[model samples]
Target: MTGRKALSRALDLSLWKGALTTAGSREAADAVTERAVPNEPTVRLTAVRRLYEVSTRMGAGRSLAETLQAVVDGVVTGLGFGIAVLNLRHPDGKFEVIAVAGSPEAREALLGTVSAADIFDGEFKIADEWGRLRFVPHERLPEGEVVGWVPDVPVSADPSAWHPLDALFAPLHSPDGELVGMLSVDLPEDQRRPGPIHRELLEIFATQAGLAIDKARLTDQLLAEKVRLEASETTFRLVFEGAGNGMATLAFDGPEAGRVLRVNDAFCRITGYPHDRLIGSRLLDYLTDGDAGRTRRELQELATGTGPYRFERTFRRADGQDIWLGGTAVIVAQGKDQPRILLIQIDDVTARKDAERELQHHAAHDPLTGLANRRLLQHRFEAALQRSRQRGRRGVLLFSDLNHFKQVNDRYGHEAGDNALREIADRLLTAVRHGDTVARLGGDEFVILAEEIDGTDLDALIRRVEESIGRPLAGIDVPVTASIGTAVVSPYSADLDELLRTADQAMYEAKHRDR
Candidate 1:
């Protein structure tokens, strides 16, 4: 018979008066049988149709507990049973009531009452006393427990007992051979016992249910991953497009020229060019006039894989202003045609370069007098000595200490002393030749490097410095004297330290004579 026809026959058999007669005592059997079979087929068909529709509706059910509950509801209502319960194997190998349906009393009594161990062992003592017979797998049951029912053993034994008659338990197994849970059913004692037909039906239902549950779980996981991936993409886009730093990509075309493929807003702002104008333009179009050829050659070498170059260059901005850019460019070709091309990265370094130049000026020149400081004087003297050695020439190193300068500072304060030093520096600068270097050696002391000078010329340079110092200050009319000492050295003298010491000693001797 077709499934619908078979269902009609089962309904007819369940409602048969003959079956009711064999159910048990007339009064009790009639009452239970009346409740099991409705007065009309329409009500029964409606229940069956609703159960089938809902069970088929299990599209993406993730939770095992929820799916099990759905199964319990569908089986009990659809099959015209009084009660249904679902039991699942716990992690510890015990069984727990996962879901239950039917009367409140039946649900409470069956909930958490039985376990897999109890059912597997055919421990039906509670069911037997309650007029209920437990069904186990034929292969699984103990031989003694597989007994045929005798007439003497009343079907409706007692109401207070643990088990119910017409109970069916079928293991719910997944497609991968995992036993997920068990489906159990109960009916009044007078109802027909569960047989192979009922077992087969329950097994099919459980298989469909299990597959639906797995699908739902996978769907939920995929949705969560998709959300995370989209979120990551949003974060990346915000950082790449909204960053303050200039970021761009250049497509390599040839040695000196490449097209700008992408540029962020910061790049446009820094280069003073619009995005539309910058894209597809050659990188060399912005290069300063003097660096065009050299940069082109470097880019060519980079493209040919012959050199790695990193240097600073000046670029003309959109407004025709020159801006210093410090950056590196390299060749990048991800297996494309004409692989010889350059990828350029540039950053505005005008502020940084200016700060470096200012620092260098402060290090070598005195802040107050604008003369070369002691450090610069030492460097120049060493360079001059090296040159003198190469040409067999001699240079004079003059160390001069201002005599009685402390009295001026003590009497007039440091401000006036500073003015006096400024006037002295100007006089020394005027007295020295263009090639000579005059430096302040700190605390009212000065040093002069006279290159390619003999003894006579050295004496003249010293006298000119002394006369300038002794000249009266123009505004303050303060007379100052500087005691001068000179040390001559050739590059043959290997000891620079000894030369500086001799110069210092001679300065002290001249100070003593002036005093």
Candidate 2:
């Protein structure tokens, strides 16, 4: 061997000795030191010191990038490799050349370079396994299967001589055996294939470096997660405060479940409540008096994960006015160990609810007389019949037709006729029992449904209603009187048409008698 080769071999032996001393037993180190370079204690100490220094820097509280860079630098300077490259695996399953320790030209050429994961898999699969180190001989490379950078060195006829195309790699793995990165080295100072001692030295250094890299990576991940959580919190705060509708976050477990944890400004405005009164208050506490219990049950169901609940509820305001709100509630699970929460979004719908009620009333009432129309009367009659049947009670229907009502409309026109009809409606309503249903079947025709009555009571009610109807109009001298008929409902009364027909026939007979 040439002097340069001899010196390189001596240095390689020294590194092996030092690695054994630091990583394992001093007795093993002594055994190796005595077999090779027995008098080169100074060289072995230098290698041991260099390895310690590199390991310290790698384990320092530095960034992942910085640690990885230190790993590659240590491989080159401490392990006597002319070039070292650390290729880190990314989430996308590709390997990126992150840190390079070599000539400036090689660093510029290889740093930031990316390789498909398939390439690494192929190389590792075919390469000779030198313990943990992978050695890919130049002859083993497949055609057109480009790997990474190759130094400009000519191949030698000697079988062990280093070639430009030969590749050596040490894969760094996490504690859980996941491959995190790979370290590539080339151009050993001896200009020959690495010996077993050289490979062992690389493995020892890689094991320690992998742990340091993994630690740095974990720290980086934790910091990134923290930043993301903070940003998410800020975004949520902005949206909750800026929303036009009421929004609330409520606790979802334990005794405090369904109580307000956070509420937006719109919630305070809608409830006429201040921030202090709303926070930590149970959602059911604001429900209108009659609905509080039912709402509480519904909220309890939501807390048990039976939601999302979409509903309309009446809530009592701070000043005791009830207002309608349309809302949705959904459970938001924070984390596996954290308590879940409920997110409620609500819109004030009092105006809409009032308008709906008004529409319903108009649909079932006579527009002209403000009395129950035929639709409402039919519904009430059915209910009343059901009650009478269930309780075995007697019910009565009184049908009345105004005498000479058409003449009054002809003389005074429709406006005065409407006023007269309204007056008549008022009088009839006043004359009947509070529970009786007064309905206008059509023009000049009215019916009263008086439930739970007897023959004597019916006679008294009919006479009272006739007297009210016989009174003269306020603004007109035209006289109007009612020709009345009655139908008594037994417990078995089931046909509404039959009852109405019987009353109609009696009404006609009474009219004839009056004429």
Candidate 1 lDDT at 20 equals: 46
Give the runs in model 1 whose Cα sits over 4 Å from its true position: 1-243, 247-265, 272-298, 304-311, 314-323, 334-341, 360-370, 455-460, 508-515
TM-score of 1: 0.45
- Evaluated with TM-score, which candidate comes out highest? 2
In candidate 2, what are the lDDT values of residues 343-451, reduced to their tens digit? Answer: 6767788898999999999999999899999899889899998898899998988889899889888999989999999999999999999899999988989999999
State how far residue 128 of model 1 sits from its true place (Å).
76
**lDDT of candidates 1 onward, in order:** 0.58, 0.71
Q: lDDT per residue, candidate 1, 1-515, as tens digits?
A: 01101111112123234554676575766576567554333332343344344454333234555566667776766555545666666556666776776545445544564454444444343232211124522233334532322112234333332122233555554434455566665552235454322333344345445444443433432111101101121011111233233545565564434677667676788889999998888767788667887876776666655222356878789999988876544443322133333434456888888898889999999998888997787788789988998999998888888877887788788899999999899999999988999888688988888899987787788889989999887555456788777778787766556776788899889777767
TM-score of each: 0.45, 0.54
lDDT of 1 at 373: 90
Number of clashing residue pairs, candidate 2? 0
The C-alpha RMSD in Å for every predicted model, in order, reads: 27.1, 22.2
Give lDDT: candidate 1, residue 140: 34
